[model samples]
Target: MQTMLTTLILGATIAAAAPLTARSLVSDAAGQTYDYIVVGCGVSGLVVSSRLSENEDVTVLCLEAGALDHYEDDILVPYYIGLQPDGFYEWGIYTVPQTQLDGESRHIPMGKGVGGGSLINGMVWNRGNQESFNAWNDVGNSGWGWNALLPYFEKSETYTPKNYSGAEVQPELQNPSVHGTSGPVQVSYPNYYWPQTNNWFEALHELGIPTSAEPNEGLSAGGYFLPLDIDPINQTRSDARRSYYDPIIARTNFNVQDNSQVTRVLFDTSDNLTATGVEFATGASAPRQTVYARREVILAAGAIHSPQLLELSGIGQSSILEPLGITVLQNLPGVGNNLQDHGMIHLNYNYTSPVLADVNDFAINATFNDESAAEYYGSKTGPWTAKPSCAVAFPSLEQVTESASSMLAAASSAAYNLPSTYDDEPTLQAGYERQMASVLSELANENIPAFENLNNNAGGLDLALMRPLSRGTTHITSTDPFTTPSVDPRWLVHSFDYDVMILAMQVNQRILNTDAIKYLGPSYEYIPQDATAEELGQILLSGIGTEYHYSCTTAMLPLDLGGVVNEVLMVYGTNNLRVVDTGIFPMVPGSHLQAVAYGVAEKAADIIKAAQ
Candidate 1:
């Protein structure tokens, strides 16, 4: 009995010493070579690595620049959504001063740890409108349409129905067939809804926008309760670490090195455009080291960093790389072009009702209460178990405005009638023409939502321009990988975006005027109720910010259309290298990016496996 006890103790010690955390330092894996080296342990990185490591023969290594989450309560609790992106687990990136947004720059928070943006996001799980994905197929990317990608969306999540007895469940909130029952990520509605959400739903119905059956099924243009990526049983935030990484971390073939940043991808000295390995560092003072990739190098460094890495590796335009004294490896002009993000403006209102619950009351109030923490830790149910419930509405151009045709005509003319800058590159012109054609058709058919309204239930309404005609770019000013890139989203540059935002504000006013919402005793706190269109437009200019849905810096269109990667997600000028993140998206889908990012990673895994 004593011998057995000693053996168990020694076994525990051995297990503890085994590098189970997947957070290895650079010194621990200096000379290692992996079958696949994945840079960035974000959603795409985790999903792709987890999938690729399923085959026991293949070794996958993931390098992340941030440390393990350590189960931070702010990240684990769903109600702490507002507090998660505190620069602890975030990159805390800031964009360049926008020329259109009153010459002001905005803070862009991106996830830095194993889970990436999923750890720092609002946890909203939206799969986007089907036509948006079909638009990718229309732009010469075959097999990327909604029908082809729907299965991948289903493959990444396990949906749970909200089962609390006291809560009301709506049939329109979910569709079981469209959601996966067995998957890594957990997605479901909150156990309880804020009292004001029902009023908002009724208000939308009264405003003539019917509730959607299931937003994830793709026809998401209507009012509905936004689904969250939370585990119903545990009542915890279901981020990429909890979903994709935790389950497979025990595999010997999979290794994740945290607090290790990949500086650049290494290539062969030969004439062949072949990627051989990657260079990384432990921290600012640590010496850089090389790690070879036997098969391929997958870059999931996200929209902003992916392009920065490419440029640092001499794969961007000659004009940008030559000035830095970096040899141009590929001269791909699209490496950092076509940046996009959803422009959002918040409208605040004063709730006159004394009995209604304030948004702060749902989470940690002015002071932390031990009893609330006890309630959450003991039963896994309470205010801490859910984020503030909200109602989302996707309204088309025609539904929101009577001047849809004329507005679209004006937008088309402004978009297609480009300046001499576009004339310099036929590829950029072709891509713009294709995007404009699709945007015009969408405006005419009302197939895609032009504006999205999110009712925060706490007298705050968020209006976002779902599809903007404006575009921007991100470029590396220097070769230093640690330096933040110049990110200019150029938001609201075109008058068309201004027109859509103005109409969306009007729609919000109409919703606020509805009998259901008006009964709640709400009054405008920001903009005046009688503000004219011009006055509202001025207010919007100062008020607009990002929805944090930045995408498409390294797009996947045809090479002739300013594409950095091909349909297979491989870089246009390189072999054995691929980008499997939001950067590969040819255009910004009209939804929150987390779910689409997971789907993209899943599909990328299949594509990579098939090629193998």
Candidate 2:
């Protein structure tokens, strides 16, 4: 960790940024007014703020509760993946006990520092699916369709084609014409890919899944190779800080303060609710400081904390706020009502025969790690550079489930429209009515996917439910800003969600029977042979996990439909304030969200600039 930090520090020293001491930070934070004050210096925060600062006349200030990550090995190295240590870099919080999973609570590790989730995520660069963004337009967000959002997606990434030119295997990838040549985030394929990927792709084909679709065009309902957010030149993680913030840190108009947690969004309550600035503090006991925003105050604190900030400032449900002795400035119940997450379950398989150059070799044999490290340092080629699973297939419901007609019939039925376990609030129910219709349309369409089957290649397959019907809530538990909010994803609460999980396991069994997969001699480690649907449902609910892609906490829809913000991303009933994060995403777009985050921030930057 120390060695990696030293190298990053040296790189920063060599960059064009002015001396760190010369930059305006907490010392210069108090009593200042900027055109834009962005809360949370995460992926979207840094992106939109930096882009706004491009005009020399505009001033942008970014505040982050956590300090900058020193670029430790666990963060920079792809081998470390999701195993970054707890505390400093992650907001490692646990959700409230899920009622359907026998009251079992789950852990959610969200990025906490300057670069945000882009700093700590698995770096899988996926552009979601075409229907996912088009659904946004259906939910009253005009001009948010695929054709409209595609340019921003391209504008956020600089793609390096993986169509190789050597004796090595060349994996099919996104077309160069569909991507940006000069974007802030660098995305490219790793030097090493699992040799068994082609075999797995063949197995998926044998199961009637196609592998020819280009994923980055928002049309990834089939198998395709995914790129990582790594610099093609250096082989290190390319996050928002490095890509968007570092290069523009020297801009005199832009300044970011670390360790400054905004406690509340300050507003003038005389006749009309209007954002003035925010009240923040360096620590819970530290003296509070107030900074004003001349133009607008934007929330980019992600799905978990963004709504918490809104409620802390009195913008959430009055029933929730009034009980906690907090005055309600706006009774917007939708501030934290539409919380959603991509639910996932993993099935581990054991290889009867050894798979050479496997990702698990490092753990199975100590000497193998040394050799991998040597290879990585020598030529930037090794298993250490590969993600746990880069080859994934998104199969539609008809392709994975046997009783597709009955399931679709049930989905279209009134019984599945408003399940008892889902929210009982009329507005939330109405909002779900719109969202459920969109999901059902996608499930019925053979071109859209119901789940993502990601072969870890070593021994596991991650089955992630792409569009879950279950909607939950994330609300402030107390008036205090330091208190952790209540996050309840309500996994498997809906009948459709349960059916998808159970059916996906059966699809796993079918995958093992394929000729290409049978060649690997794989055997399930967790699943019992010939288990009943009820028993299998129990196992799935017991071990269900979440993709780090938590979103839709504060949705963007019509105000009558319990949406927190408007089509323009501005919070309803408030002036000169907006939300620009995953919370504003009407639904979890496809499964992966990092690439979509880049696009959302890029588009939001333009929206905010145009309003200016």
Candidate 3:
């Protein structure tokens, strides 16, 4: 019966296909000069452009490498997250082979279209721990701590209470005061949750991890139902395009160039470091053109591409550009030096008894059968409205391991002797020292969650190292902007990181052994149940992957500490050039990047407005 309903509604909906409005092309742009020219229409680009274009006198032009969204069912539906990667909307980039992970290279999935990663990422909306932001302020970046950034976080989202037909919404699960009600992005919980989630939460409770009243209130060191960027009214994905750009695209002063790739920032002269405009190409084999930025040229191309653009524009480390025969415009060594990402390991388990429902059945792998589709199309409810995983737990070292103090001591010792490359330059040395101190502090404090556990409904658990000490680099190997940069995340190079991951895995085993979880009947385990920590370490090293939260490539710090941008997000040497993306993060926060990206762009808009 369910299958029949879903199929009929899907067929009817497909037959009534609506025409998508074509966005303004670059050729249609009337003027050559604009008050602000924003590159990359991702989360940051859209927010910055939307807010800047509010002033009717100022013109804001946004250039996106990918075309406008088709609003395809796969992209709009909340459950079809994992399917969007490597599709037409993806950038199709991959990381270089990671030597620590046994020479394995993982795909670096980034959204290519106007919405950027917000269009394709798993819609988990996490604000991360408060201490993570405080660490930024501690490192010379004032006005960036938790208290300073809370307003921006609240300003970006319009929080809606969870309401579904069959499932009872838990009032204690959410705190309304910390969320916004009039923001652009819509955030809410699903109406329906898998029955197995109850058992999972029970297991967490049995293990002494309390349920947080409001994790977004800056303290997320407990179990919680993760909020998603989905609209409760329409039951669709609330991406950057839908929230920020689509509403303002019709403004006369706001213009967008789709399917356009920016090659480099055009400088006034080879000797001078002034950014006048940018050179770009539209579509494949199109003629290159230059457009002037009357006031500023903002790079919101994201962490990977932002740094890549800087290098191609001759503003990166001299050693990298000089070797490529590109003239050194500004020798900023920090452009791509501090690349960091959340390394994750998935642990799969098999159930002995038939489970109530798996995410594959209704979420990511739903066949769109008649019943489910009918329910969704008719009432905007059911499993189609939810993502694969909704429940997440943030566990600190003390909660997961018995030797938290010993581990902290080891990390403190390791901090003093970081890789020699960190000390090769005074700037790099200072940055490393600050970052190491922060890492050690988090490791010692039981209040801070060192790792995250995502309860994937398919009986698989995703364990991620939230605050990793391992740092890597992303640099251009050639002068051509078309060539992909060499990205080495250097996963698990530090011994302390390996220790923490092994301990996290042990915590997973403990959760599995709980009566509430064990009743589900564990028939299989990815790693043997009796495996020792050493064996688990080996298994983790071979299978570790990224949480896709790439950040901190071009950090905001004091210039003496290898900072590429100031607190205002302007590039260190260039006056009219600024970056608005995760690349400006001083370090990777413990949460997903999308939430922070939106907040950063919101704050950036105010900064630019104040300057004007």
Candidate 4:
């Protein structure tokens, strides 16, 4: 029932209790100093420590290994975001081996502590696809196009939308001048949505697909009920610690250490990485300390701890820090290479009359906007802000050009440049290790489930093979900045991320046998229409996963392509470091990568405050 209302709003017998508040580092218990340190309060370290503490003399620390959230229910519901996988704010990261499927091992769940992965995601806000930032300004990433990041996604948004149904405006496909009405992140649209899935919007206007009232504008292929960063006047889950830390937690020059952790980054003595300081350690404590920042360090520890804290402070690659002895200070080799992620395939169905069930009692999460779902209850809006996949279908890869996208983007960019040796290595040429012993040699491959019928029936088609040219690699076996390395998001290991996860599970088994969702009430389960295409390619090489949206591990290209932050995100060899997170993207944007990582940390805090 929405997993027992998310195990009764995460009191599931104190789900491993403890966190009541002890993450103090709010500064000066004798250790005060900072112009910025920001390690991992997630969502690129709390929006670059709330925009570099708006320079009230600039002092910001923010470490966070994970705690001090309190707003539980596995992160404020929204269909229990797949029941908070590995709970306790997930860091259960799993990846590594996979010649392709049979080698299995791939759970990859990221977002440990503070607002990282926007507090364990699934809030689904998408603002991507302005041709993925005009293909990152067509590869080079200048001012990141899409009209230079559409006013930083309307200055990190604050929309609202909950007048309870009645206001169904199309105004040319939902364009309220493309959104953003006050900012500080509120976004809206969900109050409950179910009306027998609004007959798939008249089967998506009888499959012509044009019904936008603003699906975050910038063309989202087709299929739309979009908008859901959440808040719709208190319906919760507006993450980034409630859209950028509760509208600036009383600001006094922001400190925020919480459960601490930082570990390395200390330098000085003409090694030149100045303003020295940082060594944390609190949660599960054992007496560890240090905290100095006087000027700048910003890493936003994401996309796998920002390239394992820039190869544990020596700054990356001397063939990966001379055999882990360490000390290689910036050879860069793309500190953790071009990781990239977005590989789905979860086509579950089995509706007879619960039309894709909406369990969770207390009368569906406390009156999911009452008035008996009044077009969405008492004037808020309708179909309760419909999320569960509320219309989304971005096709193209010439509908899986044989087995999928130029046979697995030449074998996952040669398993991501054969481990950053880099000279254009990317050429794994889709054998998907061996295409899983040729899953039924080619059981009627069927062009994207005959162009999205998504296993025909009562709505349920999740075919999302966005940008998966198969690239993956986030190295660092050891140097121990805090050690978690070896992130290998080599998902679908390649073969166009295993033919775009078996062409989005063969277009959710051709929309369960379409005719506009086969007389509404479709039926397919997990994935078994009597198996074989070698058992749906070993249940999609082994259930294709990770949409935490990782990204090019600190990439910000140009240094002969193995870039590690340059176009003003600094880092190439340090001098004040800086990274801001989704680890400097450099590519991966089909959408929903947290409003483009808050418009690339709000244009990297205006190029680090116009270079100080």
Per-residue accuracy of model 4 over 300-394 as CA lDDT, tens digit each? 87888778766777777677678888877557766776677776655557555543544322235444423223332234344333434444544
Q: Cα deviation in Å at residue 214, candidate 2?
A: 1.2
Cα-based TM-score, every candidate:
0.92, 0.94, 0.94, 0.36
lDDT of 1 by residue, 1-612 (tens): 123332233222211112245533334667789999999999999999999999999999999988877676667777567754358798878888766767888887788898998887888888788888999999999999999998999899888766433323363446787888888999876655666777888887787776775777887577766678888777777899888988777788889889899999999848657888899997867889889999999999999999999999989877779989999889787888878889998788756676665564434343333334445666765555656464678888766667999998888777443323345777877887788678668767664788888777766788888887887788899877888898887788888988889999888888878988887777866778888998898899888888888898899999898899999999987888999999998889888889999999999999998887
* Native RMSD of candidate 2 (Å): 3.3
Looking at model 1, how many pairs of residues clash?
Answer: 0
TM-score, cand. 1: 0.92
Candidate 3 local lDDT, 1-612, one digit each (tens): 235545455534422223335455446543388889999999999999999999999999999888887778777777566755446598788888877777889877888888988888889898888899999999998999989998999999999876333322253457787889899999887656777777777888889877675678877586777788988777778899888977775788888888888989988765456788888887447777888888899999988999999999989888779988999888888888888889998788755556555664553334543445666777777766666567778888877667989998887677343333355578877887788788788667777888888887556877999898888888899776777888888878877888888888888888889998788776455678777988888889888988888888899999898899999989988877999899999889888889999998999999998888
lDDT for model 1: 0.80
- Candidate 2: deviation at residue 353, Å? 1.9
Worst 10 residues of 4 by lDDT: 447-456
Q: What's the C-alpha lDDT at position 118 in model 3?
A: 86
